[model samples]
Every structure is written in C-alpha cells, then in structure tokens.
Target: RDLHNRGGERFIYNLRAEPATPEFELHGKYYYAQLAPGTRMIWFVNLSRQNGFTGPVELKVEGLPEGVTATPVTIPSGLTRAAVILSAKTGAKIDARLVRLYGKAVYSDATGKPRDLVRYAHVTCELQVSGGSQARRPINTQIVGVTNPLDIVEFEATPSKITLRPGEKVEIKVRVKRNKEFTGPIQLAMPFLYGNSIIADQLPPGVTMSSDSKARLTGKTVEGTIVLEAATGDSAPKPLERFPIAVMGRISMSFSISTNYASNPIHLTILGADSKAAR
Candidate 1:
C-alpha cells in the first residue's frame, strides 16, 4: 500500500487487501531520512500472522538502486525518509552526487506478504564555495583664454630708439592697467637688440629684472613698472647714441597665472633703439 497527501489532511492509498481471520490485520509504520554523500536504506517485515494460507507474493519497487544496505527504521512526530548515496574521498577534490528521500512505512496481512508503505516529501538546503583576482585603468586634459591688468595700459621705454657705444645704459618701464583683478604671478621676457645689428644679449647695468623670476601681478594692476639698465662697451665711450630699445622682445615669458592654471606665454619685443642724447 502506498499513501500520499496531495492537498487535504488525509492519506490516499493505491492497494487495499482483506484478510480472512480476525487475527490477520494490516499494520503501517512511517520513517524519515536525509540525502547527502553516503549509502543507506530501510526494510519492512510482517510478524502479525504466523500460520497457513500463503501464495507467492512478489514485491518490486522501482526508482531504487540494487546495491543498497537496508535497515529497519522509525520516525518521530513529523518527518520523512529516503535512500542516501555518497562518493569516496579524494584529497583536495570535491565530491558531487544526487539522492532521493521520502517517507516509508510497512503494510502486511495474513494471506499477502509485507509491502512498502511509501509517502513523498521534500528537502531544503543551500550550497557554497570559495577563491579568485581583479585590474586598474587611465585619465585626459584641455586649455582656454588669457587676461592682464587694467592699469598696465601700455609698455614704454625711454628714447624709444637707442644707439649704444658698447657699455652705455638705457632704462624702460612697462605701463600696466590700474585696479586689475590679478592675484597670481606674471613672467616677462625682455629681449633687447641694437637695431638688428647685434643682440644686446645681456641685461643693462644697475637695473635689475624682477627677482621673483615670475613676478606676481597682484592687487591693483596700477602701472606696474619694470626698470632695466643698459650698459655700452667699455671702449666705445660715445657709442653713437641713436639706436632703439624694445621691451618684451620676440622671446617668450611663461608662468602660472592662477592657483589652478598656467598662463600661455606673452611675447614682447624691443622694436628699435636710441641713445641718451637722442632721447
């Protein structure tokens, strides 16, 4: 006899038998089991009837392997049982297998042999495992516009043109915008030449460029001035004083204009030269 519960609180069966004697009654037992990685089974026997009236009764159960070990079992209040199969242990390697678990009971009568009382049930669990690696990846940049002081109106040099004997000296001032909004440093590159004849190459005597290397056009940009002294050669006393002196000659001046950015170079040139007498 096989019993099952599909929906309600009742046991449904497939086989029913009637015994002739009052001593020949049917008995049923329930069992529960778990499936993992080992081998196990269960068996049932009928001890209620002792004598007579017996024909050859064949019991065949499908869905079960042939090589299984059977043991008589019992279940508590609410539980089920099934056949469990397991794999042999191999060092560091994982073992994997499947098993079917269900509830089993025994049914027996005087005329018929003992049969399996089976019920279907379910099992719930979780699986887990562990180890593995991870990589790094790069970034890009761009540019914009330029601004100077308002007070620094224009750049002017004395004797707009200068002619040097050899060691003669000249002075120039770069006029700046007033009340400007510059807080960062400014770098000026002054290039001086003797009217395309010979490049002054060196700075003038007494007059020094901004010590800041990079001058700061801070506060109000009011007529910021840069004074430069030009010295002529020692031999040429008069030095023909009538050449040109240019400020910010073709050379480039570069520095950081802000706390966060760098300023593109502002190129200035001394176009002509002149001497003290010419001025």
Candidate 2:
C-alpha cells in the first residue's frame, strides 16, 4: 500500500469476522380461539432457528384473562413443534384481548458463555366467537377468549398414578367426556410433536408406548387404553425416578390442524428390578 501510494496508486484491505447471535423465532397458526367455560383449546408453535441454535425451548403465554390457564410445555431438543393448551374454568366469565406467546432458550455463545434468548411469535392471533367459521380477516395481534361451549369437557386417566418395575408393562385407561355437540372420532396420544411427520411420546428414556393399545375413539366410544412398557436393559430410567405423563385427546380440525385437550397428569414411578414398590 505504501509503495502504491508513492506511485500514485491506492489500494485498501478490510478484515472482520462474520456476525451472529444465539437466537430463534417462533412460528405457528397463532392462538385464535374463543374458548367457552369448561372448554379447552390447543395452540401449536413451531421454531425457526438462527445461528445454529439447538436446544429445548420453554414456552409461556402472557396476558391471559382471569380463570384461564396454560399448561406447562417444552419443545424438546431436535423437535420443531410443541403444543400449548389453554383451559378455561367451568365458570369463567366472558373476556377477550390480545395476548403474547413467546419462547425462551439457553445457548452458549461464541465465547462459550451461556446466554438466555427470547423471541415472540411473528404473526397476529385472532380469538373468534364460538362456532365462528368464516373467512379470516388479517390482523396484527394475538387473541384468546372464553365464551362458548366447546369440545372435550373432561378427560381423565385411571389410577391417577402408577408404579412399576423395569420391563414391566402397565395399562392406563383414559376416558373422554365431551359436550353433546361433539360426538365425532377423537385420537388420544402423547403430546410431543415432531413437526407434522409424527406425534412422539414424551416419556423418560427407555420407556415407550406399546403399539398393541388402542388410540382411536370412534362414534359413541369414549374410552381407550395406553399401555407403556419400560425397558429392562440400559434404556430404562434409573430406579426411584419419577416422570409425569398426560393423555392428550386430539380432534382433527383439518388435514393439518387439530385441537388437543389434556388429561390430568399421571405420576409414573420406576421401581428397582428386584425390589418392592416404593411407598
């Protein structure tokens, strides 16, 4: 450069590192619903990653009105989507408003230091009136309210809890009580979703849902069994470990959409292979 400048010629060189951040975005068909008293609605959220982010994302709903509650859910690592279920109390009053849906995750930055990152859903959500099936109008805010009768009034799992040895297989009977208006077929399964490809079971490592159990309820049928088996070998969770599992009842809204309702959680305890059940 000095030689070139002396000869009336000029040149320049710039050096810098590529810029990046540990972050991601949340995407989904926003929580657009008018839940009624004694009803539930499920919101599905997918992740759009950036900067090579990889980890489970913890989800929360903010600005929900009184008498309405959201289930605690986490999008497992390597999975792209997770369901957020909102339930209204049997006596919830009429209310409506815009709400926020966001996700939080932890990742190590380029310096190897852990950092917390948060992101919100990119699109607006609309909370329509019950049975309001009309052409959608574009909007800019997320909405959810409590107002009309809906499906899946009550869903419960028998025994409430379970205890078993490694390699033991147990049966959990789930009963769905729905409003008189909804008598169509419903599918019951675990809550974990791997995009639209499959519905994965959310259980401890080595524990799995048995294929022999029935998962579909057609017509007047309201009860189904979910059998879980624990592996006897290395895959089983350690003795004394406990895991919480819920039965999810899904009603298809379309070929790609569904409304899911959850049952009361069941506490599952793993017993030692040669030992008696823990008290």
Each candidate structure's TM-score, on Cα atoms with residue i matched to residue i, is 0.24, 0.61
Candidate with best lDDT: 2
> lDDT per residue, candidate 2, 1-279, as tens digits?
352243334445566887788678887655475677776666666677787887878888889988988877766565566557677888899999788888989999778999998887765333444564423333446788877666777787887778877888889998888788878998877644434444334565566678877888998888999888888877765553334457777788765456767776676677878887554
Q: List the residue pairs that clash in candidate 2.
A: 125-141
Per-residue CA lDDT of candidate 1, range 174-209, in tens? 443322443333333342222333222222222234
lDDT of 2: 0.71
In candidate 2, position 14 carries an lDDT of 62
lDDT of each: 0.27, 0.71
